[model samples]
Target chain A: MKLEIELIYKQYVDYIYGFIYGMVQNKAVAEDLLQDTFVKVMKSDIDKIENMKAWLITVARNTVYDHWRREKRKLNLMPFIRRKRRDIDLKLDIERGIEKLSPKLKEVIILREINQLNYKEIADILDVEIGTVKSRLNRARKELRDSLEG
Target chain B: MNCSKIEELLSPYIDGELSRDEIIRVERHILECKNCEELLKDFQLIKEKVRGIEIPQPSLRIKKKIIGYARPRNYFLRIIFSTSLLTGLGALLVLTLGHQPYIAEEKPKEYYIMKEERTPYMEILYETEGDYILTNYEGGSL
Candidate 1:
Protein backbone atom coordinates (compact mmCIF):
# COMPACT_ATOMS: atom_id res chain seq x y z
CA MET A 1 0.00 0.00 0.00
CA LYS A 2 2.80 2.39 0.87
CA LEU A 3 4.53 1.42 -2.34
CA GLU A 4 1.32 1.92 -4.20
CA ILE A 5 0.90 5.42 -2.82
CA GLU A 6 4.52 6.33 -3.51
CA LEU A 7 4.35 4.98 -7.05
CA ILE A 8 1.15 6.88 -7.76
CA TYR A 9 2.43 10.10 -6.20
CA LYS A 10 5.70 9.93 -8.06
CA GLN A 11 4.00 9.22 -11.36
CA TYR A 12 1.20 11.80 -11.19
CA VAL A 13 2.16 14.51 -8.68
CA ASP A 14 3.20 17.08 -11.28
CA TYR A 15 0.18 16.72 -13.59
CA ILE A 16 -2.27 16.63 -10.73
CA TYR A 17 -0.59 19.65 -9.14
CA GLY A 18 -0.50 21.44 -12.48
CA PHE A 19 -4.16 20.66 -13.05
CA ILE A 20 -5.20 22.06 -9.70
CA TYR A 21 -3.04 25.12 -10.23
CA GLY A 22 -4.48 25.54 -13.70
CA MET A 23 -8.03 25.41 -12.38
CA VAL A 24 -7.48 27.49 -9.24
CA GLN A 25 -4.58 29.70 -10.46
CA ASN A 26 -3.23 29.92 -6.96
CA LYS A 27 -0.10 28.11 -5.91
CA ALA A 28 -1.03 28.05 -2.26
CA VAL A 29 -4.64 27.12 -2.87
CA ALA A 30 -3.71 24.58 -5.47
CA GLU A 31 -1.25 22.94 -3.13
CA ASP A 32 -3.87 22.77 -0.43
CA LEU A 33 -6.39 21.31 -2.81
CA LEU A 34 -3.87 18.82 -4.12
CA GLN A 35 -3.27 17.64 -0.60
CA ASP A 36 -6.98 17.45 0.05
CA THR A 37 -7.47 15.45 -3.14
CA PHE A 38 -4.77 12.94 -2.19
CA VAL A 39 -6.17 12.68 1.29
CA LYS A 40 -9.54 11.78 -0.12
CA VAL A 41 -7.84 9.22 -2.35
CA MET A 42 -6.05 7.80 0.66
CA LYS A 43 -9.30 7.34 2.52
CA SER A 44 -10.97 5.41 -0.27
CA ASP A 45 -10.33 2.18 -2.15
CA ILE A 46 -7.41 3.20 -4.33
CA ASP A 47 -6.73 -0.38 -5.33
CA LYS A 48 -10.00 -0.71 -7.15
CA ILE A 49 -9.47 2.32 -9.37
CA GLU A 50 -8.70 1.31 -12.97
CA ASN A 51 -7.71 4.68 -14.36
CA MET A 52 -5.62 6.44 -11.76
CA LYS A 53 -4.85 9.58 -13.71
CA ALA A 54 -8.46 10.20 -14.64
CA TRP A 55 -9.59 9.35 -11.15
CA LEU A 56 -7.03 11.73 -9.59
CA ILE A 57 -8.03 14.54 -11.91
CA THR A 58 -11.66 13.91 -11.07
CA VAL A 59 -10.88 14.10 -7.38
CA ALA A 60 -8.83 17.26 -7.89
CA ARG A 61 -11.71 18.80 -9.87
CA ASN A 62 -14.12 17.98 -7.07
CA THR A 63 -11.71 19.40 -4.53
CA VAL A 64 -11.55 22.64 -6.52
CA TYR A 65 -15.34 22.94 -6.48
CA ASP A 66 -15.47 22.05 -2.81
CA HIS A 67 -13.09 24.92 -2.13
CA TRP A 68 -15.32 27.22 -4.15
CA ARG A 69 -18.32 26.12 -2.16
CA ARG A 70 -16.51 26.83 1.09
CA GLU A 71 -15.36 30.19 -0.21
CA LYS A 72 -18.65 31.00 -1.89
CA ARG A 73 -19.19 34.29 -0.14
CA LYS A 74 -15.80 35.62 -1.16
CA LEU A 75 -15.77 33.99 -4.60
CA ASN A 76 -19.23 35.19 -5.56
CA LEU A 77 -17.78 38.71 -5.67
CA MET A 78 -14.64 37.60 -7.50
CA PRO A 79 -15.65 38.67 -11.02
CA PHE A 80 -16.60 42.14 -9.79
CA ILE A 81 -13.65 42.20 -7.44
CA ARG A 82 -11.11 41.02 -10.02
CA ARG A 83 -9.62 44.03 -11.66
CA LYS A 84 -7.89 43.78 -15.02
CA ARG A 85 -4.16 43.98 -14.84
CA ARG A 86 -3.85 42.70 -18.35
CA ASP A 87 -0.43 41.79 -19.60
CA ILE A 88 0.47 42.40 -23.20
CA ASP A 89 1.68 38.84 -23.67
CA LEU A 90 -0.98 36.95 -25.63
CA LYS A 91 -0.24 33.96 -23.41
CA LEU A 92 -1.03 36.00 -20.35
CA ASP A 93 -4.07 37.46 -22.08
CA ILE A 94 -5.43 33.98 -22.80
CA GLU A 95 -4.66 32.89 -19.27
CA ARG A 96 -6.67 35.80 -17.98
CA GLY A 97 -9.38 35.00 -20.48
CA ILE A 98 -9.46 31.46 -19.18
CA GLU A 99 -9.60 32.76 -15.64
CA LYS A 100 -12.63 34.85 -16.48
CA LEU A 101 -14.46 31.97 -18.13
CA SER A 102 -17.40 30.39 -16.36
CA PRO A 103 -16.58 27.20 -14.47
CA LYS A 104 -18.06 24.91 -17.13
CA LEU A 105 -15.94 26.39 -19.87
CA LYS A 106 -12.98 26.74 -17.56
CA GLU A 107 -12.97 23.04 -16.70
CA VAL A 108 -13.25 21.80 -20.29
CA ILE A 109 -10.43 24.06 -21.46
CA ILE A 110 -8.19 23.20 -18.56
CA LEU A 111 -8.86 19.50 -18.88
CA ARG A 112 -8.44 19.68 -22.62
CA GLU A 113 -5.54 22.11 -22.95
CA ILE A 114 -3.55 21.82 -19.74
CA ASN A 115 -4.05 18.12 -19.17
CA GLN A 116 -4.27 17.38 -22.90
CA LEU A 117 -7.02 14.87 -22.32
CA ASN A 118 -8.96 13.64 -25.34
CA TYR A 119 -12.63 14.46 -25.81
CA LYS A 120 -13.67 11.09 -24.40
CA GLU A 121 -11.60 11.61 -21.28
CA ILE A 122 -12.99 15.10 -20.80
CA ALA A 123 -16.49 13.71 -21.26
CA ASP A 124 -15.80 11.04 -18.68
CA ILE A 125 -14.41 13.58 -16.24
CA LEU A 126 -17.21 16.09 -16.79
CA ASP A 127 -19.85 13.29 -16.86
CA VAL A 128 -21.17 14.68 -20.13
CA GLU A 129 -21.39 13.32 -23.63
CA ILE A 130 -18.68 13.64 -26.25
CA GLY A 131 -20.91 16.02 -28.22
CA THR A 132 -21.15 18.26 -25.19
CA VAL A 133 -17.40 18.07 -24.74
CA LYS A 134 -16.81 19.03 -28.34
CA SER A 135 -19.26 21.93 -28.22
CA ARG A 136 -17.95 23.15 -24.89
CA LEU A 137 -14.37 22.99 -26.08
CA ASN A 138 -15.29 24.94 -29.23
CA ARG A 139 -17.09 27.55 -27.21
CA ALA A 140 -14.26 27.69 -24.73
CA ARG A 141 -11.69 28.25 -27.44
CA LYS A 142 -13.82 30.89 -29.11
CA GLU A 143 -14.55 32.66 -25.85
CA LEU A 144 -10.91 32.74 -24.89
CA ARG A 145 -9.97 34.12 -28.30
CA ASP A 146 -12.76 36.68 -28.32
CA SER A 147 -11.96 37.72 -24.79
CA LEU A 148 -8.36 38.40 -25.71
CA GLU A 149 -9.08 39.95 -29.14
CA GLY A 150 -11.63 42.39 -27.77
CA MET B 1 -24.96 25.08 -41.28
CA ASN B 2 -24.24 28.76 -40.91
CA CYS B 3 -20.84 30.28 -40.16
CA SER B 4 -21.46 30.16 -36.40
CA LYS B 5 -22.24 26.45 -36.52
CA ILE B 6 -19.25 25.97 -38.78
CA GLU B 7 -17.23 28.09 -36.33
CA GLU B 8 -18.42 25.83 -33.53
CA LEU B 9 -16.76 22.97 -35.38
CA LEU B 10 -13.40 24.71 -35.79
CA SER B 11 -12.13 23.64 -32.40
CA PRO B 12 -12.95 19.96 -32.83
CA TYR B 13 -11.55 20.19 -36.33
CA ILE B 14 -8.33 21.66 -34.98
CA ASP B 15 -8.13 18.94 -32.33
CA GLY B 16 -8.98 16.32 -34.97
CA GLU B 17 -12.06 15.42 -32.94
CA LEU B 18 -14.51 15.95 -35.79
CA SER B 19 -16.07 13.08 -37.70
CA ARG B 20 -14.97 12.59 -41.32
CA ASP B 21 -18.05 14.29 -42.76
CA GLU B 22 -17.80 17.12 -40.26
CA ILE B 23 -14.16 17.58 -41.11
CA ILE B 24 -15.01 17.73 -44.81
CA ARG B 25 -17.73 20.23 -44.13
CA VAL B 26 -15.49 22.41 -41.98
CA GLU B 27 -12.78 22.28 -44.61
CA ARG B 28 -15.19 23.12 -47.42
CA HIS B 29 -16.67 26.02 -45.46
CA ILE B 30 -13.25 27.40 -44.47
CA LEU B 31 -12.25 27.37 -48.14
CA GLU B 32 -15.01 29.85 -48.90
CA CYS B 33 -15.44 31.78 -45.61
CA LYS B 34 -12.78 34.36 -44.79
CA ASN B 35 -14.15 35.22 -41.32
CA CYS B 36 -14.29 31.62 -40.17
CA GLU B 37 -10.89 30.89 -41.66
CA GLU B 38 -9.56 33.82 -39.63
CA LEU B 39 -11.44 32.64 -36.57
CA LEU B 40 -9.89 29.23 -36.99
CA LYS B 41 -6.49 30.88 -37.09
CA ASP B 42 -7.28 32.81 -33.91
CA PHE B 43 -8.58 29.70 -32.17
CA GLN B 44 -5.37 27.92 -33.07
CA LEU B 45 -3.42 30.85 -31.68
CA ILE B 46 -5.51 30.76 -28.51
CA LYS B 47 -4.89 27.05 -28.13
CA GLU B 48 -1.16 27.66 -28.48
CA LYS B 49 -1.38 30.48 -25.95
CA VAL B 50 -3.33 28.36 -23.47
CA ARG B 51 -0.70 25.67 -23.86
CA GLY B 52 1.86 28.40 -23.27
CA ILE B 53 0.24 29.43 -19.99
CA GLU B 54 2.92 28.83 -17.39
CA ILE B 55 1.95 25.72 -15.48
CA PRO B 56 3.00 26.44 -11.93
CA GLN B 57 4.76 23.69 -10.05
CA PRO B 58 3.76 23.00 -6.48
CA SER B 59 6.17 23.78 -3.66
CA LEU B 60 8.63 21.26 -2.24
CA ARG B 61 6.44 20.94 0.79
CA ILE B 62 3.73 19.37 -1.32
CA LYS B 63 6.11 16.71 -2.59
CA LYS B 64 7.16 16.10 0.98
CA LYS B 65 3.49 15.93 1.92
CA ILE B 66 2.92 13.31 -0.77
CA ILE B 67 5.92 11.30 0.37
CA GLY B 68 4.68 11.59 3.91
CA TYR B 69 1.30 10.32 2.78
CA ALA B 70 2.99 7.24 1.36
CA ARG B 71 4.14 6.20 4.80
CA PRO B 72 2.68 2.91 5.93
CA ARG B 73 -0.24 3.06 8.30
CA ASN B 74 -0.73 0.74 11.24
CA TYR B 75 -4.29 -0.02 10.22
CA PHE B 76 -3.21 -1.40 6.85
CA LEU B 77 -0.71 -3.64 8.55
CA ARG B 78 -3.35 -4.62 11.08
CA ILE B 79 -5.77 -5.55 8.35
CA ILE B 80 -3.18 -7.73 6.59
CA PHE B 81 -2.20 -9.40 9.80
CA SER B 82 -5.82 -10.07 10.76
CA THR B 83 -6.70 -11.48 7.36
CA SER B 84 -3.73 -13.87 7.37
CA LEU B 85 -4.48 -14.93 10.93
CA LEU B 86 -8.09 -15.66 10.08
CA THR B 87 -7.05 -17.65 7.01
CA GLY B 88 -4.57 -19.67 9.07
CA LEU B 89 -7.20 -20.36 11.70
CA GLY B 90 -9.66 -21.44 9.06
CA ALA B 91 -7.09 -23.80 7.52
CA LEU B 92 -6.31 -25.25 10.94
CA LEU B 93 -9.98 -25.85 11.76
CA VAL B 94 -10.55 -27.58 8.43
CA LEU B 95 -7.55 -29.84 8.95
CA THR B 96 -8.54 -30.65 12.55
CA LEU B 97 -12.18 -31.42 11.83
CA GLY B 98 -11.78 -33.15 8.49
CA HIS B 99 -8.88 -35.50 9.25
CA GLN B 100 -9.41 -38.69 11.34
CA PRO B 101 -7.77 -42.12 11.83
CA TYR B 102 -9.56 -44.85 9.88
CA ILE B 103 -10.65 -48.12 11.58
CA ALA B 104 -12.19 -51.17 9.85
CA GLU B 105 -14.88 -52.40 12.30
CA GLU B 106 -16.06 -55.24 10.02
CA LYS B 107 -14.99 -57.07 6.88
CA PRO B 108 -15.04 -54.86 3.87
CA LYS B 109 -18.05 -55.14 1.52
CA GLU B 110 -15.78 -56.56 -1.25
CA TYR B 111 -15.17 -59.76 0.85
CA TYR B 112 -18.93 -60.45 0.96
CA ILE B 113 -19.18 -59.70 -2.73
CA MET B 114 -16.41 -62.26 -3.41
CA LYS B 115 -18.12 -64.79 -1.09
CA GLU B 116 -21.48 -64.26 -2.85
CA GLU B 117 -19.94 -65.19 -6.22
CA ARG B 118 -19.99 -68.92 -5.23
CA THR B 119 -22.96 -70.87 -6.71
CA PRO B 120 -24.23 -74.52 -6.76
CA TYR B 121 -21.80 -75.41 -9.53
CA MET B 122 -18.90 -73.10 -8.60
CA GLU B 123 -15.84 -74.29 -6.61
CA ILE B 124 -13.87 -72.46 -3.89
CA LEU B 125 -11.11 -73.96 -1.76
CA TYR B 126 -8.51 -72.63 0.58
CA GLU B 127 -4.92 -74.02 0.30
CA THR B 128 -4.84 -77.82 1.03
CA GLU B 129 -7.41 -77.68 3.90
CA GLY B 130 -10.07 -75.20 2.88
CA ASP B 131 -12.80 -73.09 4.56
CA TYR B 132 -15.34 -74.62 2.12
CA ILE B 133 -15.47 -76.79 -0.95
CA LEU B 134 -17.74 -76.30 -4.01
CA THR B 135 -18.35 -79.27 -6.33
CA ASN B 136 -20.24 -79.98 -9.53
CA TYR B 137 -23.85 -80.99 -9.14
CA GLU B 138 -22.80 -84.48 -10.51
CA GLY B 139 -21.19 -84.85 -7.04
CA GLY B 140 -18.12 -86.77 -8.06
CA SER B 141 -15.69 -85.25 -5.49
CA LEU B 142 -12.07 -86.04 -6.08
Candidate 2:
Protein backbone atom coordinates (compact mmCIF):
# COMPACT_ATOMS: atom_id res chain seq x y z
CA MET A 1 0.00 0.00 0.00
CA LYS A 2 2.81 2.39 0.89
CA LEU A 3 4.67 1.50 -2.29
CA GLU A 4 1.57 2.09 -4.37
CA ILE A 5 1.00 5.52 -2.83
CA GLU A 6 4.65 6.47 -3.26
CA LEU A 7 4.57 5.43 -6.91
CA ILE A 8 1.43 7.46 -7.50
CA TYR A 9 3.08 10.46 -5.81
CA LYS A 10 6.21 10.17 -7.94
CA GLN A 11 4.17 9.81 -11.11
CA TYR A 12 1.69 12.67 -10.70
CA VAL A 13 3.48 15.13 -8.43
CA ASP A 14 4.52 17.48 -11.25
CA TYR A 15 1.18 17.41 -13.05
CA ILE A 16 -0.80 17.84 -9.83
CA TYR A 17 1.51 20.56 -8.53
CA GLY A 18 1.50 22.41 -11.85
CA PHE A 19 -2.28 22.27 -12.04
CA ILE A 20 -2.70 23.54 -8.49
CA TYR A 21 -0.10 26.26 -8.96
CA GLY A 22 -1.73 27.30 -12.19
CA MET A 23 -5.04 27.76 -10.38
CA VAL A 24 -3.87 29.37 -7.11
CA GLN A 25 -0.91 31.31 -8.56
CA ASN A 26 0.73 31.04 -5.16
CA LYS A 27 3.42 28.44 -4.47
CA ALA A 28 2.69 28.14 -0.75
CA VAL A 29 -1.05 27.74 -1.25
CA ALA A 30 -0.49 25.43 -4.17
CA GLU A 31 1.76 23.21 -2.07
CA ASP A 32 -0.83 22.99 0.68
CA LEU A 33 -3.51 22.11 -1.85
CA LEU A 34 -1.21 19.55 -3.41
CA GLN A 35 -0.80 17.86 -0.03
CA ASP A 36 -4.54 17.88 0.42
CA THR A 37 -5.01 16.47 -3.08
CA PHE A 38 -2.78 13.47 -2.41
CA VAL A 39 -4.35 12.90 0.96
CA LYS A 40 -7.70 12.65 -0.78
CA VAL A 41 -6.18 10.29 -3.32
CA MET A 42 -4.75 8.12 -0.56
CA LYS A 43 -8.11 7.87 1.10
CA SER A 44 -9.90 7.00 -2.13
CA ASP A 45 -10.18 3.46 -3.43
CA ILE A 46 -7.29 3.35 -5.87
CA ASP A 47 -8.66 0.29 -7.63
CA LYS A 48 -11.70 2.17 -8.84
CA ILE A 49 -9.77 5.01 -10.43
CA GLU A 50 -9.59 4.23 -14.15
CA ASN A 51 -7.75 7.43 -15.04
CA MET A 52 -5.34 8.18 -12.24
CA LYS A 53 -3.92 11.40 -13.68
CA ALA A 54 -7.32 12.86 -14.41
CA TRP A 55 -8.57 11.78 -11.02
CA LEU A 56 -5.65 13.44 -9.26
CA ILE A 57 -6.11 16.62 -11.30
CA THR A 58 -9.82 16.73 -10.50
CA VAL A 59 -9.03 16.43 -6.81
CA ALA A 60 -6.45 19.19 -7.10
CA ARG A 61 -8.96 21.41 -8.89
CA ASN A 62 -11.57 20.81 -6.19
CA THR A 63 -8.98 21.56 -3.53
CA VAL A 64 -8.26 24.91 -5.19
CA TYR A 65 -11.98 25.68 -5.40
CA ASP A 66 -12.44 24.80 -1.75
CA HIS A 67 -9.57 27.09 -0.80
CA TRP A 68 -11.08 29.87 -2.89
CA ARG A 69 -14.51 29.36 -1.30
CA ARG A 70 -13.04 29.54 2.19
CA GLU A 71 -11.08 32.64 1.20
CA LYS A 72 -14.22 34.21 -0.23
CA ARG A 73 -16.11 33.52 2.95
CA LYS A 74 -13.35 34.98 5.09
CA LEU A 75 -13.19 38.10 2.92
CA ASN A 76 -16.94 38.53 3.21
CA LEU A 77 -16.66 38.37 6.98
CA MET A 78 -13.73 40.83 7.06
CA PRO A 79 -14.49 43.18 4.20
CA PHE A 80 -11.70 45.56 5.25
CA ILE A 81 -8.93 43.00 4.69
CA ARG A 82 -7.11 43.33 1.41
CA ARG A 83 -5.00 40.65 -0.24
CA LYS A 84 -1.44 41.75 -0.98
CA ARG A 85 -0.09 41.34 -4.51
CA ARG A 86 3.15 39.46 -4.90
CA ASP A 87 5.97 40.61 -7.16
CA ILE A 88 5.47 38.99 -10.54
CA ASP A 89 8.39 38.74 -12.91
CA LEU A 90 8.21 40.15 -16.40
CA LYS A 91 8.45 36.66 -17.87
CA LEU A 92 5.42 35.65 -15.83
CA ASP A 93 3.22 38.40 -17.27
CA ILE A 94 1.30 35.83 -19.30
CA GLU A 95 0.73 33.78 -16.16
CA ARG A 96 -0.42 36.89 -14.32
CA GLY A 97 -2.89 37.54 -17.11
CA ILE A 98 -4.13 33.98 -16.80
CA GLU A 99 -4.62 34.46 -13.06
CA LYS A 100 -6.90 37.42 -13.75
CA LEU A 101 -9.29 35.39 -15.88
CA SER A 102 -12.66 34.19 -14.56
CA PRO A 103 -12.51 30.81 -12.84
CA LYS A 104 -14.21 28.87 -15.67
CA LEU A 105 -11.93 30.34 -18.34
CA LYS A 106 -8.82 30.06 -16.20
CA GLU A 107 -9.53 26.40 -15.47
CA VAL A 108 -9.86 25.41 -19.14
CA ILE A 109 -6.67 27.30 -20.05
CA ILE A 110 -4.69 25.68 -17.27
CA LEU A 111 -6.03 22.19 -17.97
CA ARG A 112 -5.30 22.60 -21.67
CA GLU A 113 -2.14 24.70 -21.87
CA ILE A 114 -0.30 24.12 -18.60
CA ASN A 115 -1.28 20.54 -17.86
CA GLN A 116 -1.49 19.70 -21.58
CA LEU A 117 -4.49 17.50 -20.96
CA ASN A 118 -6.56 16.62 -24.02
CA TYR A 119 -10.00 18.06 -24.67
CA LYS A 120 -11.67 14.82 -23.65
CA GLU A 121 -9.71 14.67 -20.42
CA ILE A 122 -10.53 18.29 -19.63
CA ALA A 123 -14.18 17.75 -20.41
CA ASP A 124 -14.22 14.74 -18.15
CA ILE A 125 -12.59 16.70 -15.34
CA LEU A 126 -14.82 19.77 -15.69
CA ASP A 127 -17.98 17.70 -16.31
CA VAL A 128 -18.71 19.79 -19.39
CA GLU A 129 -19.22 18.97 -23.02
CA ILE A 130 -16.31 19.09 -25.47
CA GLY A 131 -18.06 21.95 -27.25
CA THR A 132 -18.22 23.91 -24.03
CA VAL A 133 -14.54 23.21 -23.47
CA LYS A 134 -13.75 24.48 -26.97
CA SER A 135 -15.77 27.67 -26.49
CA ARG A 136 -14.26 28.27 -23.06
CA LEU A 137 -10.74 27.80 -24.37
CA ASN A 138 -11.42 30.13 -27.29
CA ARG A 139 -12.82 32.83 -25.00
CA ALA A 140 -9.94 32.30 -22.60
CA ARG A 141 -7.32 32.77 -25.32
CA LYS A 142 -9.07 35.85 -26.63
CA GLU A 143 -9.28 37.39 -23.19
CA LEU A 144 -5.66 36.54 -22.44
CA ARG A 145 -4.43 38.02 -25.73
CA ASP A 146 -6.44 41.21 -25.27
CA SER A 147 -5.10 41.65 -21.74
CA LEU A 148 -1.51 41.14 -22.84
CA GLU A 149 -1.89 43.50 -25.78
CA GLY A 150 -3.51 46.24 -23.72
CA MET B 1 -17.19 28.46 -44.67
CA ASN B 2 -18.38 31.75 -43.26
CA CYS B 3 -16.02 33.75 -41.02
CA SER B 4 -18.17 33.15 -37.95
CA LYS B 5 -18.21 29.40 -38.56
CA ILE B 6 -14.47 29.46 -39.12
CA GLU B 7 -14.02 31.43 -35.90
CA GLU B 8 -16.03 28.85 -33.99
CA LEU B 9 -13.77 26.11 -35.34
CA LEU B 10 -10.54 28.02 -34.77
CA SER B 11 -9.76 26.64 -31.31
CA PRO B 12 -10.33 23.03 -32.28
CA TYR B 13 -8.43 23.59 -35.50
CA ILE B 14 -5.39 24.92 -33.67
CA ASP B 15 -5.59 22.10 -31.15
CA GLY B 16 -5.68 19.50 -33.98
CA GLU B 17 -8.99 18.28 -32.59
CA LEU B 18 -10.98 19.05 -35.73
CA SER B 19 -11.90 16.30 -38.14
CA ARG B 20 -9.81 15.87 -41.33
CA ASP B 21 -12.61 17.32 -43.45
CA GLU B 22 -13.05 20.21 -41.05
CA ILE B 23 -9.32 20.85 -41.03
CA ILE B 24 -9.24 20.99 -44.85
CA ARG B 25 -12.23 23.36 -44.93
CA VAL B 26 -10.72 25.62 -42.29
CA GLU B 27 -7.36 25.63 -44.07
CA ARG B 28 -8.99 26.52 -47.41
CA HIS B 29 -11.05 29.28 -45.80
CA ILE B 30 -8.03 30.67 -43.87
CA LEU B 31 -6.04 30.97 -47.12
CA GLU B 32 -8.64 33.28 -48.68
CA CYS B 33 -9.79 35.12 -45.52
CA LYS B 34 -7.34 37.65 -44.06
CA ASN B 35 -9.35 38.16 -40.87
CA CYS B 36 -9.46 34.45 -40.08
CA GLU B 37 -5.75 34.15 -40.90
CA GLU B 38 -4.91 36.94 -38.46
CA LEU B 39 -7.16 35.35 -35.86
CA LEU B 40 -5.32 32.08 -36.35
CA LYS B 41 -2.00 33.87 -35.89
CA ASP B 42 -3.23 35.50 -32.69
CA PHE B 43 -4.45 32.20 -31.34
CA GLN B 44 -1.11 30.63 -32.20
CA LEU B 45 0.69 33.37 -30.30
CA ILE B 46 -1.60 32.91 -27.31
CA LYS B 47 -1.01 29.17 -27.33
CA GLU B 48 2.73 29.71 -27.56
CA LYS B 49 2.80 32.21 -24.70
CA VAL B 50 0.65 29.98 -22.50
CA ARG B 51 2.81 26.97 -23.23
CA GLY B 52 5.95 29.02 -22.59
CA ILE B 53 4.87 30.10 -19.14
CA GLU B 54 7.07 28.38 -16.57
CA ILE B 55 5.49 26.32 -13.81
CA PRO B 56 7.29 26.30 -10.49
CA GLN B 57 8.13 22.86 -9.13
CA PRO B 58 6.79 21.89 -5.73
CA SER B 59 9.48 21.93 -3.05
CA LEU B 60 11.12 18.60 -2.16
CA ARG B 61 10.24 19.12 1.50
CA ILE B 62 6.54 19.32 0.60
CA LYS B 63 6.82 16.18 -1.50
CA LYS B 64 8.40 14.34 1.41
CA LYS B 65 5.81 15.65 3.84
CA ILE B 66 2.89 14.49 1.66
CA ILE B 67 4.38 11.10 0.82
CA GLY B 68 5.14 10.58 4.50
CA TYR B 69 1.46 10.81 5.31
CA ALA B 70 0.67 7.80 3.12
CA ARG B 71 3.32 5.58 4.61
CA PRO B 72 1.78 2.48 6.17
CA ARG B 73 2.12 1.62 9.85
CA ASN B 74 4.19 -1.42 8.85
CA TYR B 75 6.96 0.99 7.89
CA PHE B 76 7.39 1.85 11.54
CA LEU B 77 7.53 -1.80 12.41
CA ARG B 78 10.16 -2.39 9.73
CA ILE B 79 12.28 0.45 11.04
CA ILE B 80 12.00 -0.78 14.60
CA PHE B 81 12.87 -4.32 13.54
CA SER B 82 15.95 -3.21 11.61
CA THR B 83 17.09 -1.04 14.51
CA SER B 84 16.79 -3.91 16.95
CA LEU B 85 18.67 -6.20 14.60
CA LEU B 86 21.53 -3.70 14.34
CA THR B 87 21.61 -3.25 18.10
CA GLY B 88 21.67 -7.02 18.60
CA LEU B 89 24.55 -7.34 16.16
CA GLY B 90 26.46 -4.64 18.03
CA ALA B 91 25.90 -6.41 21.36
CA LEU B 92 27.07 -9.72 19.90
CA LEU B 93 30.25 -8.03 18.57
CA VAL B 94 30.91 -6.45 22.01
CA LEU B 95 30.35 -9.74 23.83
CA THR B 96 32.73 -11.64 21.53
CA LEU B 97 35.43 -8.92 21.67
CA GLY B 98 35.39 -8.87 25.52
CA HIS B 99 35.34 -5.48 27.34
CA GLN B 100 38.96 -4.62 26.46
CA PRO B 101 39.04 -1.18 24.87
CA TYR B 102 41.19 -0.98 21.75
CA ILE B 103 43.50 2.04 21.71
CA ALA B 104 44.65 3.68 18.48
CA GLU B 105 47.33 6.31 17.85
CA GLU B 106 45.87 9.82 17.86
CA LYS B 107 46.57 12.06 14.86
CA PRO B 108 46.53 15.86 14.80
CA LYS B 109 43.37 17.40 13.45
CA GLU B 110 43.78 19.03 10.05
CA TYR B 111 41.53 21.81 8.80
CA TYR B 112 41.31 23.15 5.29
CA ILE B 113 39.18 26.03 4.16
CA MET B 114 38.13 26.28 0.53
CA LYS B 115 36.77 29.35 -1.16
CA GLU B 116 35.10 29.41 -4.55
CA GLU B 117 35.29 32.53 -6.67
CA ARG B 118 33.55 32.81 -10.03
CA THR B 119 35.25 35.25 -12.37
CA PRO B 120 33.00 36.46 -15.12
CA TYR B 121 34.78 35.87 -18.39
CA MET B 122 32.29 38.11 -20.16
CA GLU B 123 29.46 40.44 -19.19
CA ILE B 124 26.79 38.94 -16.94
CA LEU B 125 23.48 39.73 -18.51
CA TYR B 126 21.37 38.10 -15.82
CA GLU B 127 21.95 36.47 -12.47
CA THR B 128 19.41 35.06 -10.00
CA GLU B 129 20.24 33.17 -6.85
CA GLY B 130 18.14 30.04 -6.46
CA ASP B 131 17.89 26.43 -7.62
CA TYR B 132 18.58 27.64 -11.19
CA ILE B 133 21.06 30.40 -12.03
CA LEU B 134 20.51 31.53 -15.62
CA THR B 135 23.40 33.57 -17.05
CA ASN B 136 23.65 35.02 -20.50
CA TYR B 137 27.02 36.02 -21.89
CA GLU B 138 28.11 37.81 -25.07
CA GLY B 139 27.82 34.58 -27.01
CA GLY B 140 25.67 32.43 -24.72
CA SER B 141 25.86 30.55 -21.43
CA LEU B 142 25.76 27.31 -23.36
TM-score of candidate 1 versus the correct structure, residues matched by position? 0.71
Model 2, A1-150: lDDT tens per residue?
778888988888888888888887776678778888888888889988888888888888888889888777766775665434334443376877887899999999999988998899999999999999999999998898888888
Judging by TM-score against the true structure, name the best candidate: 2
Those runs of model 2 whose alpha carbons end farther than 4 Å from true positions after fitting are A88-91, B73-142
Instruction: Give a tens-digit lDDT track for model 1, residues B1-142.
Output: 6998897788888888878999999999999999999999998998898888887777887777766776457888879978999999999988987896556696554221113212111233233332344432234332
Error of 1 at B115 (Å): 99
- For every prediction, compared with the true complex, DockQ reads 0.22, 0.25
Clashing pairs in 2: none
Q: Which candidate is the best by DockQ?
A: 2
Clashing pairs in 1: none
Backbone clash count for every predicted candidate, in the order shown: 0, 0
Model 1 scores what on Cα lDDT?
A: 0.77
